[model samples]
Target: MKKFICIISAAVACIACESRTYEEISDNTPIAQVVTYNKDVKAIIDANCVSCHSPGPQALTNYSQVKGNINSIIDRISRANGDPQKMPQGGSLSPAQINIITKWKTDGLPEN
Candidate 1:
């Protein structure tokens, strides 16, 4: 009985210590898929950025604007959490969302 309890406790400890890597979990767009502005990046920007990054001179509301500012977009979004220069002001995007933007740029900024 004591050995059974010890084994169960050991199993629980191992489970608790199991680390979850980003690639281990699913993302909105799979890494294997080709990321595009319209398909993956647009949604991420719309949901996390449009509120503050739109309807202004520095708007990111359209594909053209986003593609034009890809460098800055990637820089700002890639900032560490709590960074004063981090984008979207108060919040941050998920790792998957960030990856999508990076991959989009790497993929030559596909519009469709």
Candidate 2:
């Protein structure tokens, strides 16, 4: 009975450790410094997204297109780590890369 109790307790603890809310996860996201399109965000997008989304029908080849679709960009990237329709279809961006884009949108996406 004691062994069973210990195993159950360990299982519950593991579940608790894994069950982080989205707010908790976002709060722990790495913060980037002064993210800008030219200096940062563009590279992240070019490397991860533009391959399939650029110079094509759903283009993100330039600043205007990205800035215009900022909401969708945020949503897609935020969920990309595990979502079925995640952006960058084959792989996931690092937290820092995602943070840079998120910061750019939050900072109003400066041209510099």
Estimate every model's Cα lDDT from 0 to 1: 0.87, 0.79
Best by lDDT: 1
TM-score of each: 0.76, 0.67
lDDT of 1 by residue, 15-112 (tens): 99988865467475658878888888998899888888878889999999999999999999889879999987887777778888999998899998
The candidate 1 region of ten consecutive residues with least summed lDDT is 21-30
In candidate 1, which residue pairs get closer than 3 Å at backbone N, Cα or C atoms, i.e. clash? none
Candidate 2 lDDT, 1-112, residue by residue in tens: 9999999999999988877655455644556567789988888878888888868668999998988888888887778466887777867766667778888888889969
Query: After TM-score superposition, what is the CA distance of residue 1 in candidate 2 from its true location, in Å?
Result: 32
Worst 10 residues of 2 by lDDT: 21-30
Q: Clashes in each model (backbone N, CA, C under 3 Å)?
A: 0, 0
lDDT assessment of candidate 2: 0.79
Error of model 1, residue 26, in angstroms: 7.0
**C-alpha RMSD by candidate, in order:** 3.0, 5.1
